[model samples]
Target: MDDPVLRFNLRELPVPMVYATHRIIRDCNEEFSELFGYSRSDLVDRSFARLYPKHADFVRTGHMWGAHLPGGKTYYDERIMTASDGHRFWCRVHGRTRHPTDPFAQAIYCFQALTRPVVLGKIRLTDRQRQIATLVAQGKTSAQIAEEIAISVRTVESHRARLMKAARLTNAAELVAWFSTQNSS
Candidate 1:
């Protein structure tokens, strides 16, 4: 039998999968295109940045996840992704690098769109707001978020306040409920 991990028919895979070179998509399965509402041709030779909701998300995810690839780790995260029609939704992204020594040199990724979206329509959050929102949704306290991301607790609280105001929420508990449909589930 063929080695399942080392060989498979990309086109026939049920999962949305992409083959990328240094984070630039070079090929993708049919499910990948369908999930993102793009043609395979549209993604080929394109930077993965285009599918991200924000440049900061792309940069943050890349640096955060790519850090593990060099150590032969398969990194996965649940985050937001954008479709071609400008619709954004939650997705579980999983990736692994074949060339572990030079991680981004080549890698494969699979994306699974969550059944229920956490972001319901065009609620645009600024880069910092998005970061703060993610941390908040993940159940991180203001102090914990500040320490993790190297920002002042006051700054974190301020962002949370703004988010609450924008959402017309009364408190942090409500704010969390307003943001996460259960972070990822």
Candidate 2:
């Protein structure tokens, strides 16, 4: 296992719901049954995407496609999945390709979700800092940035210093470019 604490369907232990599916076979944990208002007998053989609109396209993404590779595994940090009532929740999805028990068949898909937020701390970067980062990403130097913003070179340097600290970068030039993409929405 790539992750030591890797758990399958552990979401059932704490979350309000959990669903598992592979092709025509499907299973729902007790929490999943209660949350979705579906009985265990009612969910078998149903397409998992029926829970969300037009789910066929989800398998087309680069991230999902990457996970389907032989002996390959991947984690999606956050994915907004829509519920039956149109509410969307962020899910941390991890998946791997499993070889079929039957020798003649192809691989199967196995996936699980984490029931916690990916980031726990308050973000330190302010809007101004992000703006500065974007400007840096645009290839602006400190003096050049100060000239555009009508600030002193020292002040721009100070902002750069603080930005690097907040963003955890080692050098101003690297931070300028990194901040540009890191802060870009």
Candidate 3:
């Protein structure tokens, strides 16, 4: 007899693994084990719900309701999963349907790991600068903001000078407009 596991593996499905049936009642291939840090045995009888955050009810609902819709083969995108080590990652999963005679198999779910943290170091803002920008956005003069925030007028002026240099704005009007749009949403 053909090895069932080998046959599934040979399909070379792009997914992390093929889930042969419902989350609680199916098997995951070896690639799934490697990617998720769980053994096939560990995941075989567990619900995919186990991989989600405790408050993620939408995931279960989507799996139940959206799975049957036409052209809805995409499983999820940008989902947040907490790992056993307490770190979190974003992921996208795509699922494909299997043949009808395939032991109730329905979908092949591929997993893409998206847990990497990307840091952009360009143009970082300090807290003081942010506060002053907020005040500028509210149309407050440096003197007025200094009084309101219990800082010296000269200190507020210094803050404004640094903010202008950092943000590359030429004048108070540009500063105000820039701050206004930054604060809009």
Estimate every model's Cα lDDT from 0 to 1: 0.80, 0.48, 0.58
lDDT of 3 by residue, 1-185 (tens): 88666453523555566564544527666667666677777777676766664533335334432434234334333344555554555456666555433322555566788634423324454545645665676677999768655689999999889878877989888986665433211
Question: For residues 1-185, could you state the per-residue lDDT of candidate 2 as single tens digits?
Answer: 58678576633464443333343325555555444455656655565565432353243332233433335333232243445665443344443444433211222332334343323223455544644554575567878767655678898778778878766779867774454233121
Q: Which ten residues in a row have the lowest lDDT in candidate 3?
A: 69-78
TM-score ranking, best first: 1, 3, 2
TM-score of each: 0.71, 0.38, 0.46
Q: Tell me, by TM-score, which candidate is best.
A: 1
Clash pairs detected, candidate 1: none
Give the candidates in order of lDDT, highest first.
1, 3, 2
lDDT of 1 by residue, 1-185 (tens): 88667667888899999999899998899999999999999999999999987787899887766666775568766688889998888888888888858889989899999875454434556767766777676677999878766789999999888877877789877876766653321
Better structure of 2 and 3 per TM-score: 3
Q: Residue 169 error for model 1, in Å?
A: 6.3
Residue 80 lDDT (model 3)? 45
Error of 2 at 171 (Å): 17
Candidate 1 lDDT score relative to the true structure:
0.80
